[model samples]
Target: MPGRVFLTTPVAEIAARFGLDPEPVANEPPRQNISPGQTVVALTPEGLQHMRWGMIPVGRVNARGRPVMETIVNARSETVFDKSAFAGTGRAVLPVDGWYEWTGERRRKIAWRIRSAEPGLLFFAAITDTWTAPGGQVVPQIATVTCEPNADVRPVHHRMAVIIKAEDVPIWLNGSEERAAQLMNPWPDGRLVVEAATGVDWSDT
Candidate 1:
């Protein structure tokens, strides 16, 4: 699960890498400790935009008719297609510099930072949704897709984010759900660098 992520590269660099336009925004500074509920940059069919990290299913309401805020941060890639919440929704790619995971006993757990061996971004496959509230408010949200861990990530965790190669972005975003699901496999071993996360601060990266 990619609960924590960091994006230290400049916005312009990210746009250039993906051949996208860097539209003017209030700020797009480097973030080293982005958590759920925080705004993160994503590449969508409509272009690059910032979306909430968690998803709230549409039409979910409480007994009192109030909007139920269900924050789903990660979706299992294996069953995403059959799941009603994600069956036909549009797909997205989250450009992350790296992700964080923990290991060891609960009392003495250690944090590790995982990044790509090669330079540039690691695009995480994700699903998006537009939720509506009773008050006529609409919110766009997203959840990262996860799959069984490969050799590189198994020691740290049982699951890892479903990463898509840059060249496959077009298919992942525009292809049919069946075709997109085909790309939801574990990232190959030896292509990732996992190391002890020591003295790493969100603002320092």
Candidate 2:
């Protein structure tokens, strides 16, 4: 699984490639370290916008009607569509330069950066929602959807984010649930480049 993600591409370039309006993120700066709870740029049917990377399950419940209280950073594709806990959630695609995963023991762990060899962006399928705080503040949240790892990712992790093709972005955002469900799978093998990630500050950023 990807423990973290990073985006170094410029916002305007990202907008041009994805056909999203650049106004909302025209001034967004390049970020090499993106973690959960931070704001991320996502593409939805409405357009590109910023949303918190973690989802706080407010009143959502499971199939048995039990409350789901965990703050989700990622949702498994296996249950995302049919899960009652995710009912009525909006869809989105999170564009990023790459993601990081780790291996080995806790203190001796190794970090690996995984990105597409094709070089533009990796679009991760995501679910979106909005949480209303007790004080009346609204926070838009999102969580990446994951599936069984592809060959490129299996060596480092057993799960990987659902990477959507550029042409399929619209389908993911506006297609029927069945069609969108079809897009939640691993990227093709050999398209990704994984290398040792160094110089990162694990404590922050």
- Which one wins on lDDT? 2
* CA deviation > 4 Å runs, candidate 1: 24-26, 58-70, 133-136, 202-205
Tens digits of lDDT, candidate 1, 63-118: 46666567789989988877655655678999999999999888898999999999
RMSD of 1: 3.6
Instruction: Tell me the tens digit of each residue's lDDT in model 2 across 1-205.
Output: 5568988888788778767689987777888788998999888778878999999998999999999999989999999999999999999999999999998999999899999998689899999999998999999999999999999999999999999998998899889999998888888899999999988777766
Each model's lDDT comes to 0.85, 0.89
Q: Candidate 1 clashing pairs?
A: none
- Candidate 1: C-alpha lDDT: 0.85
- TM-scores, all candidates, are 0.88, 0.96
**How many clashes in each candidate?**
0, 0
**188 in model 2: Cα distance from truth in Å?**
0.9
Q: Looking at model 1, report the run of 10 residues with the lowest lDDT sum.
A: 59-68
Which stretch of 10 consecutive residues in model 2 shows the poorest summed lDDT?
Answer: 11-20
